[model samples]
Target: HPWVGDHPLSPKSVIRDMYERALTFTELVSHYELARTEGIVLRYLASAYKALDHTVPDDLKSEDLQDLIEWLGEMVRQVDSSLLDEWEQLANPEEMTAEEAQEKADQVRPVTANARAFRVLVRNAMFRRVELAALDQVDELGEMDADAGWDADAWGEAMDGYWDEYDDLGTGPDARGPKLLIIEEEPQNALWRVRQIFDDPNDDHDWGISAEVDLTASDAEGRAVVRVTD
Candidate 1:
């Protein structure tokens, strides 16, 4: 199929279509295949962007290619940074012959492109709020009081038990605390745990907590909105 569908094949449309295709492939492919595919896609995207650069109206060109330009610039920066790091390591000569260093460098050098594309894909997915429910939370059980004589194993066991009971109790809104919308999912669990501690009536510890928790969410334009209540 043509990169751009029935729509007039303008430079902007072509670039946008290719980007969409690249993101789709990124999600579908394995890591090894992704690396090769990313290289090809990056080259295609670069060419498309170059074409757009010349053909786009002077008024709209900058705005049209802004994000794409940023991504390409970031890619170059990452590649350059990786090359510098490899060169510095080679200069240090850590018990390796010239051949070994070259081989190591070669293995690592191709990582930047794939890594960049994957990062872009993740960033875009997160911005678009894709599969928000599928994103895993990073549960942070705060450090236990050492004076209580709880060792690491004991603390772990206690946490496991707590979570087990928590799960058994249906993990409903009351049990899990109020739902708060955050930009990313990982921080949501940690924030929920903190809110629970803040709201616990049985807890005697003075946390100097606020009466209301301020949650954050993104607007349709991807702008941050604070003071969001459950």
Candidate 2:
């Protein structure tokens, strides 16, 4: 419990190493909470889709769950690339300068920062994806569980019980967290996704950008959120 401990840590005792760890709860909780919430919400969305017989809701004919997952992937990378992190970094942009930003302008960043930034990115992405995929315009901004008809408690339990592939993803499933969360054992969503490229090879028409691109206005056209119907 001491902010600054005087003793050194030994590996033999499980509790001994906890005291010397540098995280101090402050840095770790935010990231974990974000990942937990997003993970829970994603499972919730899956339950909703299942309830609807795996069909794209009439409101979502313009786009589907797959579109949203890809969108989340791009946002996760942006977070990793350090494009969005003031919330996780707890830094003030007015104080930060263009020159300093340039000096630290590597496309890649430390994983710790990326993990937390991803939470923020994915949280908003989940909300926006719903709207973009909706068949009709939604009246309200939030309050999705009640509107979209998801079993929140059941999905939350599923997330809590999730100890599969994600355990293998040391840093937590990278950018494809939503995709990773789905089950692949059956000839369903997951397997269908694996065969999408083969089903429509050279059919990159809908996805904003199937791969990475420069963060410029010219690339903006490719980065735009997509809507798929039929």
Candidate 3:
């Protein structure tokens, strides 16, 4: 009688409902895609970095590297070049001319305290002999640091093995080949296509494509064909 008075729903029903609420990988992938389209991924990554106590570089404006350069200019103005070298030498305790030491320190100082701390992390990787893809781990570190309970000791404990393992594996991410996606729209039509030749992501050199079309033909209804290619 007492148990019946306290609740109306059965425990089995509650458990089943809770299990149904869990997200599947497909649902998660769909959510991530939507978030990516809405720029939610950028915001999430930025927030994650902030939570980790990791310094985001001032220059990273939504993942752009130009912001880092702009901030570097501003941050460098107040810096006494001579003092920077001293700090660097102090950090490494290496013997060198004040000027030389300052140069080294100055080069590295602009990397501190900004939203793209991950880039600095990549640079740090070079010294430790870590692969470039390990840079991707920044996302995880950022999320951990962003947590309110994170502290220096926790950071050390969490990152120590991560850093060590990366140092031992000196490979980078797989090469992302070239690919292009083109999207075009007309008054009455839409077009999308993927062209293989121009899609190589690693190709720094550019090549032009030739197009032959009759200009005199009337494209009635302005039915333009838009093409999207990846």
Candidate 4:
């Protein structure tokens, strides 16, 4: 799409706004990707440990995690082989020539390695959680009381106040948690906004572009637009 006039809402300006919104959406989706990766790592850990005849440590046994794993296992077992094959073909695209397939595989190899590294980090964190729980049990000290002059409520209020101020500074849980919640609550609505600008035919706004371009098409077009305008 070309910007032909001096209009404020030119094609370039509209594309920029769409790009920013899409970028924000992708950032939100990345948080869910991390969660999915964690679930995959957990499943791998459970399966590997079982295969090795290792007992699941009591401290490491989360009921929710176990339930998720069992549900995933059942889902996998119930998947139709034909449907699985069709999904694999759709995802991998067997129509590619040998060279194209190899190039694609080469591109994916680094991503596979990166995912493996992330899985290792997640596994280590899981082990660390168990270790921390064990240490907390070993070092168990009873709660503070009036005899010790440590008012539990007052201490809690002070800590809460500190954390509340920290959160106000945007360095606490509220920073990401609320954003994720907002995006996740109605993800289809967020997606619909993007589609409305770029794909919807009856929309008022026009970006002066052909509809149904690939998601990554913006990168090359954006670079071209910048180079020409600069």
TM-score of each: 0.27, 0.18, 0.17, 0.18
Candidate 2, backbone clash total? 4
- CA lDDT of every candidate: 0.34, 0.29, 0.30, 0.28
The digit string of per-residue lDDT tens for model 3 on 100-177 reads 765655653332224233222222222121112234354433333334333345434544654453443222222212
Ranking by lDDT: 1, 3, 2, 4
**How does candidate 1 score on lDDT?**
0.34
Candidate 1 TM-score, true structure as reference: 0.27
Q: Estimate, for each residue in 159-214, the C-alpha lDDT of model 1 and write its tens digit.
A: 45444433222222322222221233233432211122221233332211111111
Model 1 CA deviation exceeding 4 Å by range: 1-38, 62-64, 76-125, 130-230
lDDT of 2 by residue, 14-106 (tens): 111211121112222352343334433333333332333235565664333444333333333333324333322334667567656654555
For each of the candidates, the C-alpha root-mean-square deviation to the true structure, in angstroms, is 16.4, 19.6, 23.6, 24.2
Which ranking of candidates, highest TM-score first? 1, 2, 4, 3
Clashing pairs in 2: 59-134, 59-135, 60-135, 62-228
What's the C-alpha lDDT at position 56 in model 3?
Answer: 50
Ten consecutive residues with minimal summed lDDT in candidate 2? 190-199
RMSD after Cα superposition, model 3: 23.6
* Candidate 3: residue 128 Cα off by (Å): 31
RMSD of 1: 16.4
Error of 4 at 28 (Å): 33
